[model samples]
Target: MSESFTINRKEQLLEVAARLFKQRGYAATSMRDLAAELGIEAASLYHHIKSKEEILETICFELASKFSNAIAEVNDIYFNAEEKLRMAIKSHVQIITENTNQSAVFLQEWRNLSEPKLNAFMKLRDAYENGIRVILKDGMNEDVFADVDEKFASLTILSTVNWINEWYNPNGKMNAEEIAQKLCDFILGGLRKKLVTDINYKP
Candidate 1:
C-alpha cells in the first residue's frame, strides 16, 4: 500500500478500536471483535495496529495530550483566574464533545493499561489536574474566589466535566458551548465569594 493509504488504515483502526472500546469496554473487546468491525481478518488488523493494547494507549495518550495542550494555552493567556478557568472548562468540554468516543474510552479504559503505561498515564492525568488546581489556588489567593481546598475543587470541576461523554448528546438541546457555559457558571458560582451586601442583608 502507499504511504498515505498506510496512514489512513492506521487511523481507521484506531477509530474503530475507540468505538469498540467505548461500547464494549476495554476488558471485553477482543482483537477479533475490532477486526470484525473493520471487515478484515484479525491477522490483518495486526498489520495496522500492533495489538489491542496499543490502540488503547493511543486513544488515552492522545486525549491526555489534548488536555495538556489546552491548559498550556490557557496558561499563556493573560486572563484573570476566573476567565482562565472558564476557558479551560470550554476547552475541556469541546474536546470531549468533539471526540466523544475516544474521550469515553480514555476515561473508562485507562485502567486496563499495563505497568509502565499505566504509570505514565497517571502522571499526565495528575499534571492536567494540577493545572486546574493551580488556577483554583491562584483565584483564592487573588480573593476572586472563596478559600476552598484546591485539590477538592479541582476534582469537583474535573469530575463534572469529564463525565460529559456519558450523557452528552450532540443532537440534544444543548451544544458543547452551552454546556460549557452552564458548567462554568455553576462551578464559578460556588467558588466566587459573595459580598455582604450581595447576600440580601437587611439592616
Candidate 2:
C-alpha cells in the first residue's frame, strides 16, 4: 500500500476506536469489535493498531497534549486574570466541541490507562487544573474576585466546563463560541466580588 493509504487507514482506525470507546466504554470495547466496525478482520486491525490499550492511550494523550498546549498559549498572553480565565474557558470549550467523541473518551477512559502512563496523564491533568488555579489566585490577590478558595473555585469551574462534552450537541442551538461566552459569563459572575451599593434594598 502507498504511504498515504497507510496513514489514512491508521487514522480511520483511531476514529472508529474513539467512537466505540465513547459509546461502549473503554473496558468493554474489543479489538474484534473495532475490526467488525471497519469491515476488516481482527488481524487486519492489528496492522494499524497494536492493541486496544494503544488506541485508548493515543486518544487520551493526544487530548492531554491539546489541553496542555492551549493552557500554555493562554499563559503567554499579556492579559488580566479574568481575561485569561475567559480565554481558557473558550479554548477548552473549543477543543471539546471540535473533538467531542475523542474528548468524551479522554474524560471517561483516562483512568483505564496503565501505571506509568496513568501517572503521566495525571501530571498533565494536574498541570491543567493548576493553570486555572493560578488564574483564580491572581484574581483574588488583585481583588478582582471574591475571597474564595482557589482550589474549590478551580474545581468548580473545571467541573462545570469539562462536562460540556457529555451534553453538548454540535447540531444544537448554540455554537462553541456562544456556549463559551455564556459559560465565561456564568463562571466569572460568581467569582467577581459584588459591591454593597449594587445590592437591592428589599426592605
Task: Go through the candidates in order and give each one's C-alpha lDDT.
Answer: 0.89, 0.89
Q: Write the per-residue lDDT of candidate 1 for residues 1-203, one digit (tens) a residue.
A: 54453558788889988988899999999888988998988899878777778889999999999999999999998468888999999999999999999999889899999989999999999999999999998888788888888899899999999978889988999999999999987886656677756432345
- Please name the candidate that would achieve the greatest lDDT relative to the true structure: 1
Q: Summarize candidate 2's per-residue lDDT along 1-203 as a digit string, tens digits.
A: 64553558788889999999999999898888989999999989878777778898999999999999999999898478878889999999999999998999889999999989999999999999999999999988877788899899999999989988889999999999999999987886655666655332223
Q: Model 2 compared with the native: what TM-score?
A: 0.90
lDDT against true structure, model 2: 0.89
CA displacement after TM-score superposition, residue 199 of candidate 1 (Å): 9.6
Candidate 2: worst 10 consecutive residues by lDDT?
194-203
